[model samples]
Target: MLPNPTLDQLQVFLAVAESGSFSAASRALNRAQSVISYTIANLEAQLEVPLFERSGSRQPKLTEAGTAMLEDARRIVSDLEVMRARVKGLKEGLEAEVAVAISVMVPTDVMVDVLSEFRERFPSVSMRLNVGELGEMIDLVASGISTIGIGGAIVKQDDSLSIERIGHSFMMPVAAPHHPLARLNRPLTLADVREEVQLVVTDSSGHTKGRDFNVLSYKTWRVSDIATKHHLIRGGLGWGGLPASLIYEDLQTGRLVALELEAYEQGEYPIYAIRKISNPPGPAAAWMLEAFRASLSRCPNLEAFKAQLPFNRSKDAIAAE
Candidate 1:
């Protein structure tokens, strides 16, 4: 049977590669230099490949084979460390996997920032994320499909679920530059918007079925996803409200124009984190909720809209539990 190189061998190899010298690697690993050398020798013997080339007065240089294998060795060592940490977390009652369902309306940058932090904080915990529109986020959590959900407020209260308001998103009425509303040359009235095709985002979960929150136009096209709605609106196919955070750059660049409506105006939608009361979130899940809230609070677009609102009113609105 072929000899197998152990993790210790790979670790020693990586340490040497990173530190650039056996002596430096030994100091970094708090091991004897001879032991490090012996382990590398054994590893090379097992693989029948020279890992490092040694000269009488020079630092050990990695052989071609060693350079090729260096990244694989690092990945193997990293995976092992992750496995160990995951085992330890499981032993401490931290969930091995957490499913998160977030709203499509949530700023993508904020989601990326929060998930990046979550990965750093809980490297061992696996995450399954679902991005959906409106109440679908809540439905996923309520059905136990997700450990937690972050989305717009749930109008239909379910006794089995607990919800906490985490933040607020401003939904601004906007349209593409060439859209009729943008070229009206006068403040837009409801009658003007009523004649245009209003692009609206609907929920797949039917939570908002048979209801209209801010339907200004009589003619409407409903889609289930926010990205599609944004695309359609950007194409000048219609006009609709979109999260301010998502369209800040589009607005700034004049790709989309905020409508100066006569009566209907931009509205603030409360963002919430929901979890089943029956299956309360574990430590990792709880941490994710707070991380999302922190990320949303730091969003510049949301912050700008928040600044226009009464500070105390915003606080009071977000304190909804």
Candidate 2:
């Protein structure tokens, strides 16, 4: 009766078949030629079939059964290699999976750069991104729905959370080309701003309930997310603050014009890297934070924004205040 095949026996069979000779297989496997020949002989005996056709030639030919078995043997070995690598990664405090919550307030360029690098750096770690705004973003980290949160620290932080202000996204008030605010070439007065409709991104989460930031216009159109607010502004629905990275093309193409609001000075909204205090960032998460910080620091076109700003507030000044 045929016996069950062993991994070693199968491996030896594959090596011999692939290398075309028992001596070559031994050289490739760093085993004695006799050991390779014996393993194959035992494997063939266990299977009740000859795997290699031996006509006293230096190179043995694979039988039909041996060739057919190669595919399964190769697959099993490849799967084992992957499992070994994953186990090693786990032992090194590497995260099996990571979910990063990036705030929409973070510059788009920074996100793309950091994420691109992260994929290369942590090839084995599975990644998920939760892009949110204001408190909704923070809530994800606090609730452990996201591994880390990258956005504004709008809500008062709690002991359950750890926050670090990494960098800032330059907030510019923008209006579509044909909007009333866009037509006003000079700095707009408080009355002018209050009179026009302002599109405000509201925090849907209860963390910052009823709180308003820079909502100047009494006639405000509230939206629950930044993308919606951006879409509204683009359709000439209302004017609002958008990250410079988002409007870079719009401004360049004259599709959207940065408004010169006397009542509202263009400033940097503090971007933070936050995570749960209990579940501090793991190796992959930690590297991602640094990657984000470095990328955000080099966010494109501070000079371009400076040249284009009707009035500028330095990031340091914004920090101090």
Q: Specify the highest-TM-score model's number.
A: 1
Clashes of 2: 0
lDDT of each structure?
Answer: 0.83, 0.80
How well is each residue in 1-321 modelled by candidate 1, as lDDT tens digits?
586889999999999999999999999999999999999999999989999999674799999999998999999999999999999999998999999998866787889888888899999999998887777887798788898999855877888888888877778888887777877645788889888999888777888888886888989998878899999999999999888878877876667777767566555577888988889888899998988888777655544664543212222322331
* C-alpha RMSD of each candidate structure in angstroms: 7.5, 7.8
Question: Cα miss at 135, model 1 (Å)?
Answer: 1.6
TM-scores for every predicted model: 0.88, 0.73
- Candidate 2 segments exceeding 4 Å error: 1-81, 300-304, 308-321
lDDT of 2 at 36: 89
